[model samples]
Target: MSGVAPGASAKGTAARTANESAPVDDAEVVRDSRPARRGPGGPMGGMGMPTEKPLDMRGTLRRLLGDMREHRLELAVSVLLGVASVVLAVVGPKILGNATNIVFAAVISREIPAGITQEQAIEGLRAQGQDRLADMLTQVTFTPGEGLDTHALAVTLGWALLVYLGAWLFGWLQARLTAIVVQHTMFRMRARVEDKLTRVPLSYVDRQSRGDVLSRVTNDVDNLSMTLNQTLSQLVTSVLTVVGVLVMMFWISPLLAVIALVTVPLTVGVTSMIAKRSQPQFIRQWRTTGELNGHIEEIYTGHALVKVFGQTDTAQRVFDERNDELYNSSFRAQFISGTIQPAMAFIANLNYVVVAVVGGLRVASGQMSLGDVQAFIQYSRQFTQPITQIASMMNMLQSGAASAERVYGLLDAEEQEPDPEPAVRLDEVAGRVEFADVDFSYDPRNPLIEGLSLVAEPGQTVAIVGPTGAGKTTLVNLIMRFYEVQAGAITLDGVDTRAMTRADLRGSVGMVLQDAWLFEGTIEQNIVYPIATSPGAPVTPEQRERMLRAAQATHVDSFVRSLPEGYETVITGEGGSLSTGERQLVTIARAFVADPPILILDEATSSVDTRTEVLVQKAMNALRVGRTSFVIAHRLSTITGADVIVVMEHGSIVEQGSHEELLAAGGAYARLYASQFAAAAIED
Candidate 1:
């Protein structure tokens, strides 16, 4: 049996990967390989953790948001909540300033002589030549003996607390809603990618990096989901906070507001520059991660072969190289993105310093009250808080976007040709398969098969024997339409196969691949898979009876009955606990139950022992009754018994006839036969 190799798929274009690419017949199993942290709280909680601008940042963002359009309602509500939250947060500082003014004014008011009118006190201070002091006192609002209106102060402080609490509530709600939106969007995105995989052509898949495709599906999707959730929640609020706080700052004192605003442009420029440096690294990190995953998956899946061939050290060395590459890129991306937060903090401090010094001067000049100055200072900090958050979020967004673009590339990949309209039906008795002047190629520059014509008449067994890369599997690939023919037509029962839907054409044929592939399921399920997959597979009272008969016929019943579960035995990972010969028998049983008019066996007996081969050969004989069978044979016994033996060399038919007729001709088939028997003689 041909074993799975990395980059071979059990099915055509399953993410364009396979655990089974083999030179045994040049046919591969199209296998689709579908293959977190926090920190710091309580004692000063939470500073937690791309962009050389993504190659197509705007396009990626637009597409991502478009995918999220279905959740617009939730997003809209979240945005509204974010805006309301900002409003409350912005007003909180102003309200607390009022409370501070109340207490400070009451304290100042008590210092004035008791029972003296406010104007008289101011005049007395002016008379004493304390004009500046008198002028400052005029701005204070308090009655004599007020002495810090504890009740009023308590009321003002309560309002401030309510505003702050309200802000938190809205923000929490906004975050919750945004989480829902992001999760659903991610859900749809994942589905789209999975669906896209099935439609991806094998040619496209093979040409693309398997590791990269895997990363897009796994790592990139996850990064996008995470970044979107975290970024979206705060993104709206942060932006609105910047806008709202700016308005409040300007209202409190335009001069100080302008100074605070100056830091914004500088912050943006710094973030942009840092992002440009980091983005490419983030992309590289993710890309390298995919490459590592691909390599690991390739080696690990085929580990038995690796060990058998003693290439473990080689595999490990390759892994180390990729692992090291991943580390360097990840470190650079993290290191560069990491600098954003601290740099933003520094800029915020500078802005705070500038706004503080100027506001203090305004307060001293009596142009602004201590309360107004306090509010402006608070607003200045609030303004930079959101800007800094946005700056930090940019790193995350860029990383996610890089992943997003990768995913989009997969989704945007050219899909397979759609099944034909008005498809021809093939539910007839006769099975005459013909390849008429068929021309095909894996690469246009290198033609593998040119002007090849062949036919398998009804109930005839045609055995194809050839050297490796002699276009044996490639011919089968064309007939099966795994890879389309470049020129000429393939027909079944006088009807062009292309005119028939792929499903219908394939349904009319049964294939026993070299790998004898089976999934994790009950033995009964495995045996019936081919039939079960067909829409017309009869599910009658005799379905079980047919399965039992097929199992018994294939010698599968003998061993299966020995097991406790019989047909109910569960096999995992390509027939767990079953011998390779047994797996081959299971596939034969599958084809037996399918009972298609045409049977294509790729070295079906290669896995069975000599003794078992006799029984399997008998079972195959029974299964082939009245069926047009094409065998890609590897043994003399298989080729000599065929009604027709076609000798192939370098993509052309060198000789074709029955064993006796070809042996009499003494051409390519004779040489092939002589070589095979000679090898057997030497072994003897």
Candidate 2:
């Protein structure tokens, strides 16, 4: 039987012949090697801020607040609970102070002795003796003052209990809210990153290391999650503590409060300056860590290659360089962040001394009472605690911000827009494909295939032969719509391929490529991939019988039957257990099981030996009986009987005819055939 079935082409074979017989220009022969463009990623803050520019703390906080507002109800509740807890806790110190003041005032107003002068009253206590007497008086004085009554004590105890309850409640709520937010946010961020990855062009993934992408998704998000869970809530509590304590300080003694403000700003400014410097270091640390991960992943994947090439020393040196840099960055970040707490502590101690000295003089001069000075001292310590805490939390916030920015950068990437227009759905297809004046390039500036056109009729076998980089694989990529055409139309059975949904288009078309990737699964599972898409599509005994027949046709049935589990034999990842030829046969069987109307074979039998090639070619003949097949082959002998031959050079088809016609024409194909099969010709 003739290979091609009789079918009318909208444009006859003469038009196809004219399309295939075009000449190539020398300018189009030299191809550009640069990969395609993909959208970039970074923080929402634009990328150009100089490294010298100080960190924008306000901007960082704004971003954090914006994220929190995503779950405003929970944040509001947490904040309210946090403020209430701080208020009750601050009241503890205030009540304690009032009790001391009551006792000290009684002593002051008691007319201690008729002979005791102002100097004698001052000399009545040692420098440190005042602190000791203050402690003693606080325990003694609660008997009579209205503020220290049973009602107040009961209320203070009740407030203390409420403070404990509020801390626990806020703690629980913060944990719950953090769990909900981080899980949801991480899920959303991962989804966004995945969406961007799918649409941002395939070339980007090829150029960027998989390890770097993995680090962004895994390590960076993990760091952000940890920070959000702990540092964020601590930050809120610290701010509330500082605000509440400051208020109490002003109430007890405005003089002490003003002196406290002097150190507060200084500590904050110094910490802010240090944190700003360390932010870049943290960013650098993560970047270096990412690079290290990439290297480790590469070494793991290509261990055999490295060993065989004796490059272990070189690899180790490279790894050590990145590792050492990461260590240095981490050390600098930790060391700088660590200094803030001690520096703030030193300042806090200095302020404590100043408050004690100034408040002591005021008390001695009778401008302030002794109890008021004690209360002021208590307020001073309370104020400093929060300041110290804020400084420490601020360091964490900087680190978290750096990590969050990296994560958010990935989430914010713009993916390639899907076709807005709805697509046509095809239930079944008559396999006829046409390419009209197609122009394509991975890089738009340089065209790979320019003004080329061709057609394959129903049940016809069309062989496309070309040199490397002659747009052979590019042609198949376009057919599969891995890329969109720059200026051209591809049609299937007179319908523009662009009008069909990619899912539907791919569903009806099957491909077996040079690399036959067999995922980790059973043999039966691999064969059933296409049909398995619809959960409702049930496979019956008859289908299994047909599948077995298909496997037999590809000569894989023998090998499979030999396996311990037969059809249930599991293939490891990438089919590592199988040889190249065996894997190819399994792939061919997969295509057979799908039984699509159209098949594209890109040198599918090249890995097999000649004897095995013939067996595979026989199976391909059976598979192609009622389908249109486009075959790309380097072994020209196998495709001698194809219905049409389209020979391409440097993205353009220079000459095309049947195998016999091309041999007779003595063009590029004739030369290739002569060079490849000359010795075989003598054997023939």
Candidate 3:
């Protein structure tokens, strides 16, 4: 069990412990190991963060937009609303300028004295070739010392206020619609990524840290979603605002418009340069964050082992190194991206100054009115405002793109090859398993098993005994189809295993590995998981009875009944609450309840104490009565009663017979058996 427990090494166990403990929200651990945040250019570190490679920005953006195609209608509507909103906003200053012009014109008009007749004032206006003004004044009642047309001014101001109010209302609507669209898009993206994870091969999972994978699913997706929601709407609005303002500025005064437009290229150039430089830093920052997360996950999981091995100091040092790297990368990325806003602001301010000065000159020269000059300055500000917004949004977009690239990379990873079509399914398997002329290797360059062949007749106990790394578990892995044979076929009841779907193949066999895996659920739920979740007909009362009997057979019922909740006890943290031996018993019971025609027990009792092993062996013997069983054991005593004992050495069978026959032959099995007893004697 020491050798076979997944990642059972001192360091590996420690890491697994930390990882398992992570979901529990251990505040003390988090606070102590919390990543240092040194502002913009430091590590944006968190648990389960992922490191990513440099991405092709164009490709990522194209793919991200392609993903948004399903929501194109919503996106289009949002953009249209944003455009309308910005256009309305752009038209506001001009309307207000008209109101100002009205007031200015009214103030300059001559005052009508108390004695002056309305017809006389109208005749005076007509004498100055102001026929339109004279006609408009004919309806007005002249009052003493009334210098301005107050009613006309009030009406113009009211119209300007209504236009501004309309712009605000449209802008608000645009924001609400954009939120809905972005949220829906994010939902689809998250769902797709999650579905992708289910299809990805275990090989890929084996190569990645659980934390890193989780980071991609949670943190990366969140980053993409948040940035999309914030930046996408702003992106649309900013662009339309810039364009609309530019058009209005040109209409007002093309000379001033051209001057304002000059600052745009400079702003863009500065932004592009900073973005390009910051991009690599952002990439590195995210990567380091992942590394840091991976480290933290490992350290926290293995904290128990760290204490056992007195490695706390060593672990801390490793963490600090990763944290510092994350900090440096984060600092650089943030500092560079941060410069975009200020740099853009400076250029925008400079443009505003130039427009204000130039418009003042134009107004003085009689080339433009005071109202037109004021409106032009406002348009210039509006135009530069969008450019600055776009620059700021670009920074967020770049970060989002980096995150999207990582997520897409995960989505694009190779999936498990599709199951063969028209695959065979067995309703009832006789369990006569055979491995014929199998050749395999974890790495092609270094072969682990070559030309391996084995057979187990129905209801027979076939015991496989070998020293460590003699391809014991590897053989079972092949039978289970966790890996496919490289050169030959593994068959069940004379039919090729590959001819059947993996689900069908695995469903016919029950496996109890060295390390017991229990999820966060009740003991009863874990025990009956297989039957409950099976795609076949729902579990019957008979099956429930069988489950209870199996638990009793495995002695799991003994300790379970002692607990206050009995089988109803909720197991958490991968069954950390249970003792190692107790967990093993539960797994055995689970396998017994599964009750497949075939059974493969790989070091099932290797980790338990002597007393627990005795109970487990007894349970296994009872369970094996009518099933073809493959027992991979290191302890010679466990396999002594088997009908056939196969001794393997260096991936090949060296001896095969019953225990008595093998002992009489004095072969590899005899030597292995003798050595075990010798070690036992020495320990005693």
Candidate 4:
């Protein structure tokens, strides 16, 4: 029902009217917001793009590789292909050099020294110990008068064809191996993330921004996959290529090889410098991206508030500023990263010129053959190619390292202490709960509850009432073992809760939170979620009937019946399609379906209207039969019928007795009841 504000509409109208009156000013306003490019090959486009922050890259890669290690065969195959690719790429130039030399020698012998017979030339070449006789005799040239040697040319063509096939085959294998490693790694990482999210203390989530967590699960993992699948594989190939080329270069000419190797340290130095500087930027960029997503989510979720305040322009401006910051950060990261390619290429070309000039002199001075010079030049080129690639892939390495660090950061987080021993499942648990001298605090510096003590006998309905932030929610959290108490023990039927497995403890206690989150699925799915928690549970007709009765008791069945799909009706995420009251009823029905021995209803009907509250109360009463129930209620009237009402203040029990006794005490409970009832009476 929410829409844009009237003030925003008026402002927009005024702007339009002004623009109509003077279009020139409006046009200038638009132009200022757009990025400007100054000259040809300006820094704005390709040069100054911000480098990606390194945080996400390291974190993401570490997480991905950790998972990738799970599929050893795929990773092993990927590595093997990578090594083979490097070897083949290095071998290509050598083969080409040999072919070019054979052709050159044949031409020089027959034509350069005129009237040199083919037979005399062959004998002279062998006498000079330049015995390329076998290769030269078999070689064929593409001359204007003579047609191509269909046989010798075919041999050359066949070798060339094989090289091409090897390249393609290795390339294909590298791609497949990289894909499998990335896919399986991401799958495992996703599962681990989800599992950790569920098991961690709720307080941990409370301390973090939801957007940040969501970003880790989505953007961070995706970036990891990209870096791993694309960058990591190439990085491996580049390293092997560099090694292969270096070895070939040494074999060709050790002196020229040393000259080529001189550029190695400089290239590595520059690459390392850029990588070090760019990592932080990539981390910052991803952080900003997470912040931007959070802002967008906040705006959309609170669209009604935005309209109410008539602050659409203000919000939009804020969003634009954040978005621009991201763009600038990204630009800087990418610019630095992109520079690596051209920088390495420049150094490589410099090396190439040095190798060519020095080798040519050696050949002309009779110190080396033309064939040796040619081969040296080819090896030099090959050497630089991988160096350039490695320099380029350094950016990817940075990105992957960043992602790996982030993933490891999460993995390194200390989980809550696991239960000391395996749990023993009891066929039936008496619903008695006891809190003995319990002391707890969300933050150690600020204690919420100190020396709190309480007990609920089996089949008793105990209600807790207190002002906001008086440790009401903390009590529920402790009961569920979401947070361990700093001192004292919480027991169920005289057995310490901590002694039992968290899963077993939680499975025995059913909770209906104030805000219920339903996933994007059918109504039936939500009800059946409890039983499916086990590995082998089946959804039978009787289970469905029980769930339906539970819903009907809470009056949710009526709404389901009115819907187009009844029990099969699909709900949007977080139950957005359902009304708040309906969502509450659904949660109540879910708890009923769970049918645990101990029930905790934390503000179960606080947000519902009178009719819905009454319906929920009835359903709760039915469900509470013969079970220990802890009800934390804001509305005093709802808990008036409870067997005991315990008043709390600042984490301590102030009063406890039957509601009637507390009302007669004319203390905190009486004052709370009077204030609320007085407000309702005034409205009436």
RMSD (Å) of each candidate, 1 decimal? 7.5, 8.2, 8.1, 11.7
| Model 3 ranges with Cα > 4 A deviation | 1-54, 110-173, 533-547, 680-684
TM-score computed on alpha carbons, candidate 2 = 0.79
53-172 in candidate 1: lDDT tens per residue?
Answer: 346777899998899888888888999999999999999989988887897788788888678777888888899998877776776677766588889889988998899899999999
Q: What is the lDDT of every predicted structure here?
A: 0.77, 0.69, 0.75, 0.70
lDDT score of residue 605 within candidate 2: 88
In Å, residue 650's CA in model 1 sits off its true spot by: 1.9
Across 160-207, the per-residue lDDT of candidate 3 in tens digits comes to: 777778778877887888788778878887898888876665445545
Candidate 3 vs 4: which has more TM-score: 3
Q: Where in model 1 is the C-alpha error above 4 Å?
A: 1-54, 113-117, 127-135, 427-430, 531-546, 679-684
Which wins on lDDT, candidate 1 or candidate 2? 1
Best by lDDT: 1
Candidate 4, superposed: residue stretches over 4 Å from native: 1-80, 109-150, 309-314, 359-375, 533-540, 679-684
Which candidate has the top score in TM-score?
A: 1
lDDT of candidate 2 over 1-684, digit per residue (tens): 011111111112212222232334432332234423221211111122223333455676577567656788877777776777677667666666555555554555353444544344444544546754433333333322233245655565566566667656766676676567666766776676666765654433433555666777788777777777766667777788788888988887787889989997798799878887788787776666666777787787678899999999998888888789779989998899989999988998999999999988776555666656776787788788877877887666777776667666565544443653777666678888999999876545555688989999999999989765566666776786666778889998887878886667777777776666666677776666555543224456776786788788878898788888988777885676777788878878878877889988877888788877877898788778899999988899889989998998868888888999999999999998888866654553
Better of 1 and 3 by TM-score: 1
Work out candidate 2's RMSD over C-alphas.
8.2
